[model samples]
Target: MSAAAAVLREEIGGQPAVWRALVARGAQVAEVAAALDALDPPLVRIAAHGTSDHAGIYATYLLRALRGWTVVRDSMSMPLYYGSPAARPGELAVGISQSGETPDVVAWLERAGREGATTLAITNGEGSSLARIADHVLAIGAGAERSIAATKTYTGTLAAIALLAGQLAGRGPQLADALVATADAADALLDGLDAAVAPVAAALARIDRMYLVARGIELATANEVALKLTEVCYLGAKAMSATAMAHGPVAALDADVPLWAIAAPDATLPAVAEAVRRARAAGAPVIASGPAAAALDGAAFALPVPVVPAEPLLSPLLSVLPGQAFAWALAGAKGIDAGAPRHLRKVTSAA
Candidate 1:
């Protein structure tokens, strides 16, 4: 195997170990929780780009669903380039960066701090640029994500966000326990990948474009998974919420355009099931994952995840594992290197 391909395979299977490592750093997680609780902000605003932005989206679902906080996933361009308005006093602004040196993210967090909002940084880098400015920082703790296409760091962000949300829900211990189980579930998912995911990967290898629809918190997973498809496999992929697909996006479905859906066992499952049923009826082959894997009945493919069901917010960590494997497998099927895709870098900073 090529070195790049080997690295991608190793990292894809290495996610479980990364999650366990983050849980081992209980003290650091507690410090982050203390800072968030102390702020007690009425609204949470976040700035990030790419995969980090998807991590913030998962956190947004948790804060809104579990704590009833108004969460905004900011585009960062407004404050960084457009001179947007300042944040209000009762607001908490968060900046997420794997490298912690993205100029736009740093600029946005600095701007929010100056506007009187408490700032927090979630990153993998220790004492990096974003960490220096923020009042509090939570390390993603994935440890040395060397590949251009991220696997462990993305799951690390999900786990870290789950830890924070669990603290807010007054179940820190329980959530930590759940995260340990999640890591085990991730291993089980990885163990079955070579056999269970090969056909699914073969099916997707020839496809040139696809759509991924995920409902509720799983929308976060859909976005990240879609990004992987494009980043490594060069599949023209678009991601949207289940509701958006039902409302109007469904018209685009056809036999030539497949839809990959995350049908997790959440309250949104009923809605997602209906959407998938309708899309399949409209001739769009659908691939589904999670406990509601049945939602993809008669789909071209279904990759079941071995997940220990937790709160809806925490399910993304498990569901995303299969997506990562599928991307790597698809890359292998197409004879391309997964670790280093064309025109991509491990740390991309436009500013």
Candidate 2:
């Protein structure tokens, strides 16, 4: 393997360990949860960019599904350009960044604290600026992700969110156990993943662009996968919920543009299967992943993943693995270094 591929693979392989370590640090997570509960925030606003933004999206779905909190993805531009809206007392403002030095995110969290909202930072950068500014910090503890494209840190962020949600919902012990299961499942999945994804990567390399579809919680997985393809493989990938695809984007499907569907065994599986059928009718080849992938009628390829039945919310942590593998494989096929995509930096300063 090339040096670039090796670096990316190491980061990808390290995800399970990072997740287990995050769960092991349960005391800090519980303390953060208690602080959040004390605020009893009626609403949550999250500020992040790129992959971190996708993690924020997952957190929106998670916080709602688990704690039934009103959550919104806060646009940092609002604070960086236009004046930030006055934060209501006891509102929760969260800033997610793999590296905590993102200027806009740091600024947003600092402003949030000044505006009387409780601020939190979920980041891998324990000593970075954003960590210092937030009222509470939930460190991802992924430890020095070397690849420009985030692998472990992204999943680490999801794990952190899961931990926080579990604590807030008073299911910390159960969720922790589920996360350990997820890590074990991830280890098994990673063992055979590259060989399984090689052929799919070859097919993907022939396509210039792709569309990814999912629903409910996996909607974030679709979006994150699209970002990975875009960053690592230089594809013009778009992601949307299955319902949204049917409403309009489905018309764009054709033989030339393939569709990747996250057909996980969840409440949204039926809708996603329907979308797969629609894509097939439109002559778009479909690649489906998740435990229910094989059951999705009309999928050209199925990548079945292990599922945590006890905690359905933890599905994203498992489902996104195949997507990450595919991106790395596609990058290798195209002779691009997955670790170092052009015009990208490890830490982006969006301010």
Q: Give the candidate number with the greatest lDDT.
A: 2
lDDT of 2 by residue, 236-325 (tens): 999998888888888889998999999777678889989999999999999999767887887888888987887878988989999999
| Model 1 agreement with the true structure over 204-288: per-residue lDDT tens digits | 6778788898788888889999999999999998999877887777888888778888987757888778778888888988888
TM-score of each: 0.95, 0.97
Q: Assess each prediction's global lDDT (C-alpha) against the native.
A: 0.83, 0.89
